[model samples]
Target: MTFLPPDPPNQSPAQRKRKKKKRKFPSQSGFWTMMKRKKAVEEPARVCGPSNKVELDPDLRFGLEKAKRQLESLRQDLTQFRDRLISARGSLDRITTEESETLEGVEVVIMRKEQDILGLEFDIHWATDYAAGSRAN
Candidate 1:
C-alpha cells in the first residue's frame, strides 16, 4: 500500500481543495498557453506558389490561364508532328530498301540480256565469214 503525507495543519479546507484542483502538469499548461498566444498573433496563411490567387488581377489571371492552355496545345501539336515525322522516315526507309532490291534485280536482267546480244553478234559475224569463204572456194 502507498503511504500518504499528512495535509498541513495550517491550510484551510477550501485552500486544500483549490490546490488539489490545480493542473497536474504545470509544464504542459505553459506549452498550451504559448501555442494559443502564437496562433492569436499570426496572420492568415497564403500559398507560397508562383501565383497567389488573392493578389492576381482578374485580367492577368485570365491571360495566365490562356497562356497555359496555349502551351499545352503547342506541346501536343509538337508531339503529333514528331510522330508523323518518325512515320514518314520509316516509310522512306522501307521504300528505299524496296527500290534498292528492285534495282539489283533489274541490273541482273540487263546484264544477261547484254550477254545474249553479244553472243548473237558473234554468231552473225562467224556466219558471214563462212559464207564469204564458201563463195570464194
Candidate 2:
C-alpha cells in the first residue's frame, strides 16, 4: 500500500509552476546599509603617514608601558643568568681538568716509588747471599 497527499484544487498549474520570490538579505538592500555607504564616501581619505605613536586608551597605555618595563627587566635577568651559567661551566671544566692532571701526577709518583722499592729489595737480597757465602768459606 502507498500513501499520497492530495494537491489543492484552487491552485492552478501556472501558479504551481511560478518561481519563488528571491529573498532580500541585510547587505543586499537596507536603509542602514545605504546610509553607511553614503557616510563612507563622504568621509575624507585619511593621510598615510609613518607614525610611531599610537592612540591608545590611558589604561591600555599604562599597561603597555608596565609590560615593556617588565619585559626589559626579565631580559636583563635572563642575560645575568646566562653569564653566570657560562662562568660556572667554565670553572667546572677547569677544576675537572686540574683534578685529572693532579691524579696523573700522583700515579707517576706511585709508579716511581714501586720501582725504588723493587730496586732496594734486589740489593738487600744480593747482600744477604754475599754474607752467607763468606761465612761458609
Candidate 3:
C-alpha cells in the first residue's frame, strides 16, 4: 500500500504544470566579504595634525586643567593601592612569623636568650671606660 496523499479535487491547471528552477542571486554580504577580509590585513592610516603652534584658548586651557586633575586623581588612587598592598604584605609577613613562632615554644626560647644575656659578665675594658667617663662628669 502507498503512503502518498490523494490530489485535491479543486486543483488548478497551472498547478499541474512543472515550476521552473529559480536563478539564485549572489548574497550582498558575500560580495563585500573579500573587501572586509582585506581591511583586517591592512593597517589603518594614522591622522597627523599640522605642526604649527596653536594659541591656547580658554576652552583648551579648561580641558588641560581637567585632564591634569584626572591624572592627579589617578596618581592618588595608585598611591592608595600601593599603600594597601604594602599593608597586606606586612600582615602576611606577621602571620607567617606568628605561625613559625608558636606561643609556648617561642616564649621559652626568648626567656632562655634573656637569661644568657643577663648572666654575662661585663667586658673589663668597656666597664673601665664607662667608670672613667662617669668620674669626668
Which candidate's lDDT is highest? 1
lDDT (Cα, tens digit) per residue for candidate 1, span 33-127: 98785443222222233443223334444654565565556556655654564577675355556655654565555556556555644544444
Runs in model 1 with CA error above 4 Å? 1-95
All candidates' TM-scores?
0.30, 0.33, 0.27
Which parts of model 2 are misplaced by more than 4 Å? 1-19, 26-55, 91-137
Tell me the TM-score of model 1: 0.30
Ranking by lDDT: 1, 2, 3
Clashing pairs in 3: none
Per-model C-alpha lDDT, please?
0.53, 0.51, 0.46
Report lDDT (Cα) of residue 54, candidate 2: 23
Instruction: Please provide, for model 3 over 1-137, each residue's C-alpha lDDT reduced to its tens digit, 9 standing for 90 to 100.
Output: 87756656976545644343444765867868966854432212121234322233344346545655655565566556545645776853454455435433544554554444343222222333443443345
The TM-score-based order of candidates, best leading, equals 2, 1, 3
The reply for model 3, stretches above 4 Å from the true place, is: 1-55, 91-137
Which of the two candidates, 1 or 3, achieves a greater lDDT against the reference?
1
